[model samples]
Target chain A: MASSPTTLRLAVCLFDQVTALDYQGPIEILGFLDPNNVKPDVPTPSYLLEITYLARTLEPIKATAGPRALADRTYDEVGDGEQFDLILVPGGQGARPEKVPSSLLEFLKRQAPGAKHVLSVCTGSWILARAGLLQGKKATTNKSVFKAVVENIHGYGIDWIPKARFVVNDDKKIWTSSGVTAGMDMANAFLEYLVGKEAALRIRGIVELSAKEEGDDEFAEYYHLL
Target chain B: MASSPTTLRLAVCLFDQVTALDYQGPIEILGFLDPNNVKPDVPTPSYLLEITYLARTLEPIKATAGPRALADRTYDEVGDGEQFDLILVPGGQGARPEKVPSSLLEFLKRQAPGAKHVLSVCTGSWILARAGLLQGKKATTNKSVFKAVVENIHGYGIDWIPKARFVVNDDKKIWTSSGVTAGMDMANAFLEYLVGKEAALRIRGIVELSAKEEGDDEFAEYYHLL
Candidate 1:
């Protein structure tokens, strides 16, 4: 008899002025967890992820670009104490440390301890840093604002990797990626970690995405952040 | 004084069971048109896009994955006679030729005649083909479903390119891309076509997306479509 697939609940944080790609990209890559969606009809992976989009209100959340997105639930509905298997924070105009909401920080602070994994893309790491969850951890953020993020979030003691497309702190169950589209690369790596290389490779092939390694980041050098 | 930015209206098609990434990825690349969101803040491009998401109705449109997306208008709101500068169609379960709404086909048949550009990603081309927009035009679709799509859509007389990431019909102002993530690559190229190489290169740098040439498709060979 086959073993039961592990069900992972995911919380995707949404906010006004969020960059559409920062979160949407990862969702696209990770969405292949549903076996029916995978091309060539691959067997079900050992893990299945149930995604929930959360926001402060049920109102439509306007992104920095593209169409607005609707959240599945509000932060108040989930409460700070609710634990999820995975928590995703995506960066955009709203994620600027100064612009981030106290509610998001408080929610992260309350949930990170109990979450199995916490992931972020672009300046989403700034929210994680501001929440103090990345203290003494290795992480990366959007390369364009790399210096500003590192300077602004003083004393987090976070090792902000300058030359990484994505950083994974296995000990802390945290993954951080750089910029808008890098989230897809990080999600690809995360998929490999959750399932295996073969499954990840299959999805990558289906999507026709060329995978970039953690150290393959050229933006760090482009922005003189290295 | 610099010339006033040209406002190009965009119509994004949405439906139930649409693939989030299929549409979201291109929007991320193209959304850089809003000068305020660009990193390092370059001068505004000559053309600015006003995006409007169009669906059959105003209710939140659920994608095949991730959060639900809200449309800016309904098909009735835009009417079949409305014209747009650009029209984007993304593919997923709902985009199957048989599943697509006649309202969408009518909208495309009406709009494609006057739109500056009409773009489709993944199985989105199938919708175009069914709408008779891609008749005798060069195009491509998701490689996993390439054979089925080509075989299924009969008498379109479309030049289906098996060894390409995206296909552009300059004469017809039609652009189609392969699979899901390939939309980003096509959008990058489309950006160049709209704003010039330098501007597109800068946006690519900010987003950390490496450009892929239209002929750089590996999935074609992977699926033996080449």
Candidate 2:
């Protein structure tokens, strides 16, 4: 049997103080689809999940931990209307600054227009909010920062959907999740959507993600109490 | 108000497959001594918690997540007869290998002689066992690998304490915990030992880890049945 075509471009936006796990969780899961690991029955025998750290420049981005991660490409490098299959924004202290860099906001706005899917982990949604991409959209973030996201960003109508641990809004084009660790959960959900439930489950088993969508209700209950 | 003489030298060991959260959970709490946020009265100013990765060489260690984390120093560089206040080993697939590298095992054995306290997260106890440090000692690892740690290693007399969620044989200078995520709990337990319960609670509050330790019983009840 002939192997299926591999074509999925995933660009993860990175900046100072980007939560390392947020970007790592998704990248690890997707990168595991190496050609060597492809099963015969899989439609996409070897899915090319190309991950790039979309930044303003190729400078080293400092993570929450002291280590600095180098970016693969700049915003302009992938410019000229090149469409990506998925665009991910990670959240951390970096997202809470008083002023969102205009270049970053413009880059995000432009990326959101043509990407097949736009996702945010924790306060990464704040970036989308500043870019005017989350207007009237249901979203979530680090529970502590939820109020900040809602009260601070103007003209970005955000319906704080506290019930869903992670919310997929506006027809799956926009996805947002809660806290630093939930990035893995969000990635698993997206994998389930892109591939199938079984593939997602297989990946989850490999990664040992203890919490699932079902447990989201428990998280919601805790969130309410908090 | 001279700061109390620094007593503890906390070294978070890094190697292939080291879980980031395992090291981060304790380091975040111990490294930052922000008393204003948690407890005002506690006089436990942050000690000199030196975070370093103990690797065979100066080469960057590959974490399970694929990113290369550079170590500050190699095991050999620490010099002969150097004593550590505490040594932390994190769990991951790297620790589960049939044969622990001779260099690593030698380093662990040598270091164990002078360490004031030793802690292991998830399967990190296996590395301790390979060094003959767990002989005649009670310890635990991630529930999945506990049995292997007991039965697989030869001439290592471990009690294989099964009931406790996390085991600390203070007499034996050994601390072990379950699974990848339990590093946080183990770290908290260590802090409680060194700085007292009040200090531990304060750090836990800052990290938002106030929840009760998720014991092995809960893990078995949920996942083992499935």
Candidate 3:
């Protein structure tokens, strides 16, 4: 990586009934990965992120809440040959295996395998597991449904940690986080890993927000992640 | 209020170049306030929040980032005769006085005065101040550019606090927060103030996220907010 790698193309998955924060929180944090949003004073990172919202179509994907994000392109549009630098998948009530669109699963299987980084927020990890990308990798998911989701998806050779804030599989190039807002924390950790502490610190400073390692995760105990 | 207020109308303003998380974070947190997203197992709050995205037009309001959210109605369509239970204002680089649309100022002037709650996230407080809504009221804005923005809009009778995470003016029904993501903390604090601690705690538990009172804003000091 040079002082800046010029551009890092990102493919962000959007879907109906998606939990908006799962992806939105991390997306905002990762926006700092874009060089265009950089300030002159901040120590520049090695790459700039250019995000493209991907869905089944170009229409607005309705989130579980009233909020909706208009997709920039469809899964088919990317084609099997198109390789993204990063792939971000978010989760919601609609993320259940029975409810997820086949196109989304097929798209993930094709793109995520070759992407530089594959990140999943909340139950999005479940989707990645479904796509066979989580096999032989360490990952985590939304704890509220962690046991049910992980148990249902067992036998994939994946190490599922219910009490983790986020688990990174540098070997597999996969990063998975617990629950919704935890995505923000994972994004921060992943950004620091890729872009260095100086860049990550600048973003947190500007936003008056923190991206920290919150491993206590009381929900794990409450939900009995066993 | 009573055992449960039943319904609470919300007007969330969206615009081109708006910081998505400024409003998105709040919207996700407040989704619990709406009856539709509530689960029977999770304890319900006293009221249900009904949100309506109000923009300059009914078109898709583009965020500075790649995401875009469609507006449910327009400012002109909201009309002064219609009063919202709450008015949520989000900010971005485009939120400056010279850049904000006149229609937004007109809409705020007409609507915010009568709304049950007037909330501003990030530099959204700057917009409220421009509309004369923050006059003689304690408030804050995005600390990254807080001092300069506050100084530029001086003589609005604004008691701008550079270090505060968020401030509440119960008499004026105004709530202002710092920077982009601080809106979530403010939202958490405001929810507790209005609906009670139990509801706020439950929501935090369910999401497995925490928003703290970060008043000693290091960004304010680093940026020389003094």
Using lDDT as the measure, which candidate wins?
A: 1
Candidate 1 clashing pairs, residues 3+ apart or interchain: none
Task: Please list the C-alpha lDDT of all candidates, in the order they appear.
Answer: 0.86, 0.65, 0.82
Cα lDDT of candidate 1 equals 0.86
Which of 1 and 3 is ahead in lDDT?
1
Q: How good is the docking of model 3, by CAPRI class?
A: medium
> How many Å off is the CA of A144 in candidate 3?
1.7
Q: Which regions of candidate 1 are displaced past 4 Å?
A: A35-40, B35-40
**Please, what are the lDDT tens digits per residue for candidate 3 over residues B4-111?**
566889999888888888898888878888777886655667788999988888778877765778988888888656788899999987798777878888999898
Least accurate 10 contiguous residues by lDDT in model 1 chain B: B34-43
Q: Tell me the deviation in Å of residue B183 in model 1.
A: 0.9
Worst 10 residues of 3 chain B by lDDT: B210-219
Instruction: Please rank every candidate by lDDT, starting with the best.
Output: 1, 3, 2
**Segments in model 3 whose C-alpha atoms lie over 4 Å from true places:** A1-4, A214-218, B1-4, B214-218
In angstroms, the error of model 1 at A217 is 1.0
Candidate 1 fraction of reference contacts recovered: 0.83
Q: What is the DockQ of each candidate?
A: 0.76, 0.21, 0.63
| TM-score (C-alpha, index-matched) for candidate 1 | 0.96
lDDT of 1 by residue, A1-226 (tens): 7698888888899999998888888888788885546555555588988888999888889898877888888876776445788999999889986677677787788888899899999999999998888988999999888999899987879998999999999684999999988998999999998988888888887777888888889899889985
Candidate 1: C-alpha RMSD to true structure equals 1.8
